[model samples]
Target: MGTSLLTNSSAMTALQTLSMTNKKLDMTQNRIATGQRVSTASDNAAYWSIATTMRSDNKALGAVQDALGLGAATIDTMYTGLNGTVEVVSEIKAKLTAARTPGVDRGKIQSEITELQKQLKNTGDSAVFNGENWISVDSNSTSYNSTKSVVSSFSRAGGVVQIDTVTVDLEAIKLYDKKADATPLTNVVTGASAGTLVAVAGNITVQVGTGATVNVATTTTSTLDSIAKDIMKLGIDGLTVAVGGGQLQFANRASVNGAPAGVTIVLNGGLTAPAALATAPATETGKGILDKSYDAYNGTAWEVFSVANIDISKLTDNAADLAKLETYIAGVDDALGSITNAATNLGAIKNRIGLQQDFVKALVDSLDRGVGQLVDADMNAESTRLQALQTQQQLGIQALSIANGASQSILSLFRG
Candidate 1:
């Protein structure tokens, strides 16, 4: 090649090498300072994008964690309330058992029962968490009962993000139905005309003043007059039962208030046709004091406890009322069983929530490690690379300067 001092090709080659080396050095410095291999989309678009999306998913998982915590707290509160209900009901059963003894003031025993029932209501109302009450029916729910759900997981496959949730059945947990606004035990039975008496086989329960539950039954072939015979037998209790003549009524004896506690004379089995009783349900402020469908012999006959079943203020010291108190005690026992089942259900859900919380924590940690793999720069490796690239940059600059001096030597050959 012909040598030309004006066009030093060697200097240009060295300058290009230095420029490339400087660019590499800058990249190493950036990796060291930012501590990330893919800090921008241009660094490694695919890895950068994957890591960006993973970070977003991690944030969503954080929200799910928060929701799980809230659900656990709510369920715990409900379980506490259910335990309280069990205790109160047990106390009520004990009081009813004590009232069974003869010569004891049943009127006073019933007053204590009334107070215990009030405590049950208080327990249900107070078992609220973040304004959510699992045991109490919501007035605004479209259905009679309500259910609940808690966020559990967030996942992304392809481009779509999906959220998973754990659902709980609230109907099984709640104590009162929507219909029982407050007075749960008050039932109104429709009474038939007294003139049309049809006596079929069935038993009648007369409850008064926390006393024994007096049960009277009639045979299928028996007439209303036979039921009257049964009623007369109870007169010694300071209360009287009147059956037949299209009506069944109970009234306090002359010694007591002399008012009727309840009366039911339906045709089909025990339940009166809704349409038939609509016109004339035994009434005192729009409800009957007696449970029309309840049977003294059948345990399942009594479904729920009502607040108006026995009024202490209106009880009489009659033999009939004292006998009816026995049946009431049995009814209370049935109610306790139901509350215990509900509490068990809440406990099961609480355990599940705790497990979900643990899983979420582990998942978050795994995701952080995954994100690190996609973009995190190793400090040990990057720090060493930074030094090596800096040395190459200095050597390349020196080589370029030495190459440019070769042109100056050619100029010296023609120097004066």
Candidate 2:
């Protein structure tokens, strides 16, 4: 028998065909098992890159959804605080109403006032969110340290934007009374003579105008305020009283001691004017306005003078306190509404995320199917192809054997 060469064309051709069939079977197996087309860059570089980018986008969207959830929490906290503040204001308004009633005991009103002040302080201090205070102290100057929790921007216009810090002025509502009601006359000498408040011992009368007069008897050391009231009540048009050098001096608003045009101060009884007079008629000063005179804080303390005292009765007139209360209530209401809106928006965003998640999931499934189409083997088809290849492979082996037999036949000639 002759040896067949290792490089025989029949052997090489069968080996090459078998190798090709094996590679195809392997690819089919990989696709069926792994369920992906672009398992590697070697499989399909372009498809793999596209799938990778899509996955990244899905992750990014999920992260943004998480951030929106956090915003919702912050808004919830703010809403709670606003509601509390509104309740406090409502209570204060009620208390104020009760105190304003006629014949109400001053002590009870004072007690209520003190309580109200405490509540106000609490309201200003208690409203907080996210480790921040929301209220700011009210002062003439614009800037100050704030203690209220301020909700900054959480707007959704393409993206969430933060707003500038807002601070509530709690002290803007606090009220106080001012001292010193009347202005005193200036530039006069008062001792025992010259500008003496008393002409003789133990008797005195200060005349404001021709018919207007203030009689002060038996009382000494009366403040300028005490004497000015008598002069004002006289209805003297322009005449006023001022204390200069211990003497009650009469002067007019016009030129020194001169009345307003036709107005005049005429003295009756034993009253007599000093030869020399003083300039600068006394002017009404201090908290002349009623509103500014009352202590808004406790509502108890007030100026003793008229006009300077704020009419506490006015607060109950339905025209005054209602509008003011409503104004404050509206602010709280608006804040609460904003919080609700924020929550709603956040919920919508979350819903969108959920939809996106569902879509992404579906997209992933579709992409997987597409990948399967590219690489996965249909088991039925692969099984049939495998059988065909097996048969061909067997036939190639038989044919190679036959070809070797031919080479054997060539050796038979030598055998003969």
Candidate 3:
């Protein structure tokens, strides 16, 4: 090409090449600074889009990891409480076993057992994590269905996001299940009527209240239906009875308008008392008043009973009382066995949760690696490219300067 004084063709060509080289150098510098070969849609649009989508998915995977952590914490909390309860139950069993000795001081032993029971209640109540308790249910709940799930994996399939979860079944391991007491009116008060219990002929003065009383006179031939009317006249809530198995099966309601809600069913049994003026009336010993039964779901049926129906205030050192203690020991052992099985189930669930947590961690790591592969810059390659581009940039500037000097040489050719 021919050169000119105003515009040297070689200089113009060199200027354009230098400009292109500078542009390439700028892009390489940006990549180095950002550490990403595809930072925006302008840089390899397809790769940029893929990286953007993968980054969002990685964030979702992070959330899944967090959820897994929370699930693990909940399981740990429940396991702690259940383990403590097992220990407490074991202690209670030991106490009950020791109480079986003929001369063991049961009152003292019961005091210790009572303390252990309180500990169990505390542990159950406090085993909460993130406001969730798997071992113990709320007091207001009548029953519990224990099942939980944790977010484990997130993926895209068929252009749709699919979330996977890890589930844990804690039903077999629930310890402090809140159960509603079977109401006397709903459960115990049967409509079956019965014959009157006549211990000789006498007027039975039933104390309906603290000071309020009702008198029902029964003859040797008086049927029980006649006596039930007097009980209704007292206006007791859900109170009913039928004579069966040689005893009056009475459902003493918890609420009454009279006597502050405590009722004593003491039919006058002594033969010498006058029907109208019975004195020294025989009182039903520990047979009346409100009672509550606690029930636990044992996988198939409800096991309903109060723990020992314990009342150390009334325990005696008689042989009959010792036999009662033996029965209590057996019941306590049964409770221990049931709770032990429940604890074992909880442990198994805990182990399963632990494995799921590990899986979540591994999945998160894999996701990170995948995302890295999609967008991460190779430092070695980038650094090498950066060095090469920088050298090219310097050479481009030198060439442009040399081309610009070529125009100066044209001016020299015209110089004196």
Candidate 4:
């Protein structure tokens, strides 16, 4: 009944059918191409939002997994370093034990001990990562780090992640019990017939002449060891002096060898006549590999003292030396045991990280599945939809044709 072309039923019906067919085709293509049921807000507003969130969660979990892997590697490096250090310590212990045995050559042991010290220093100096030394400068802090703790973070899903700093305690390597003695010895001279008196600290060295000098090593705190060397020298020569009771007794030992009178005594290092000589015995003390301190776990702390401090002038045989060495070595062994325990603790931490890595890996897998469920399209369903859309488009075109046929009938009526 409408005259205007815009109001034509056939035209309106065809346009509506075409629009519906295009919409169905679009949905089918989206599912097939994107592999997603909800690709955009227009397709499914709420489902799209949920999928977006799930995808983000998966990314976060993946990141966490990466960081955890790196963390595990870091722990491995630390453990490897500790193991090397332990081997070095064990070698030192073995050498010390051998050195303590009877009939062992102590001179050889000293040489080996010096080598061991060099190795220890090398190990400390060589601890590094990425061409950078890992050794810490912080006092009372760990060797790997001053303040940061080793940590690894993981997400419930596979996503982005971060790694925390690691710290290793290097103090276990230090041996602190041994103390060094740095006191200088005193000198005293006695029994001089005509030489002028020179003052020395509890000891005196009389210089006789050039070339020849006699060295008299002394354990006495009141006397100096070099006094004899000074008074008996090459140039003046022929001069002979005997010293006792902190007194210098001068006699002409010079024969045709020369007149002892030709020698004049000069005191060096502040030696003086009338000086009283005193002696103190040297004692043995313990010396540690490093300047560090530790609490004893099994025995009394060890100390090193000079041999002169002990009452015996010398140990009569290797047997006696071995006994003394054993006593001191026992204390060192105890200290080393504590270090082993600390390393054991680090081992435990490494194991924990291993477990955590496993957990993170499983979590990442789970997150991956969740993200797939959120965004993945069903190919089978999309195939069915494509077939259905084709059928609908065919039907829509046929219906549009039928509506045009009705308009053609109206044209026939107009012809009549």
Best by lDDT: 1
Positional deviation of residue 324's Cα in model 2 after best superposition, in angstroms: 11
- What are the lDDT figures for the candidates, one per model? 0.63, 0.42, 0.59, 0.48
Ordering by lDDT: 1, 3, 4, 2
The ten-residue window of minimal lDDT in model 4 covers 293-302
Cα error, candidate 2, residue 323 (Å): 13
Model 2, residue 161: distance off in Å is 17
Write model 1 residue lDDT over 1-416, tens digit each, in one string.
Answer: 76676787888998998898888888888888888889999999999999998999999999999999998998899999888888788888898788776667867887898888777777877989998887766535565335588888899988888898877776556664443221112223334452454546777554443345567776666654455456556543323333322444333212123322332223333324222212222322111111212222111122322432544334345544443454455446655765787778778888988999999999999999999999989989988887888888888889899988876777777779
1-416 per-residue lDDT for model 4 (tens digits)? 65443456766778798788879898788889988877888767877776787676656656656665665565455555545555665665676677655566666765665576566556545545544333212332243332234455533325444444345544433232223522211232442333344433432333332435333333334332134333433322123233434444342222222212122344443344322111211321122223222111111122233211211123234433544454334434543564566557667777877777687677767766776686678899889989998888888888788876665655665684
TM-score of each: 0.67, 0.39, 0.63, 0.57
Q: Could you tell me the TM-score of candidate 2?
A: 0.39
**lDDT of model 1 at position 272:** 45
Off by over 4 Å in 4: 1-14, 41-46, 131-144, 155-291, 294-328
Each model's backbone clash number: 15, 14, 2, 66
Model 2, 1-416: lDDT tens digits are: 44465546666676677677767767766765675545777888887765665455445445444543443454344444444444444554455455545455535554654565465445545545555432322333355332322332222244444333333332222111233434333222233445343323233344433434345442355343344444544544334344433444443332224232222332322344433322434543222111111111112111121211212433433423433333223323333343344334434544554554455456556655555565454677666766776777677677667765655565666884
Our tally of clashes for model 3 stands at: 2
lDDT of 3 by residue, 1-416 (tens): 67767767766777888788778778778878988777889887887787778778878878887887787788788778877776677777678767766666778987887787778778877989998876666434555444577777788987799998766665445555454444332111122233224445777666644646667776766544445445545544434433333233344434433122445555653322212212211222111111123222222222334453443324466644553454454445555665677667667766876787677678778867876787778889878887887887788788878887876666677678
* lDDT, candidate 1, at 296: 29
Selected candidate, larger TM-score, 3 vs 4: 3
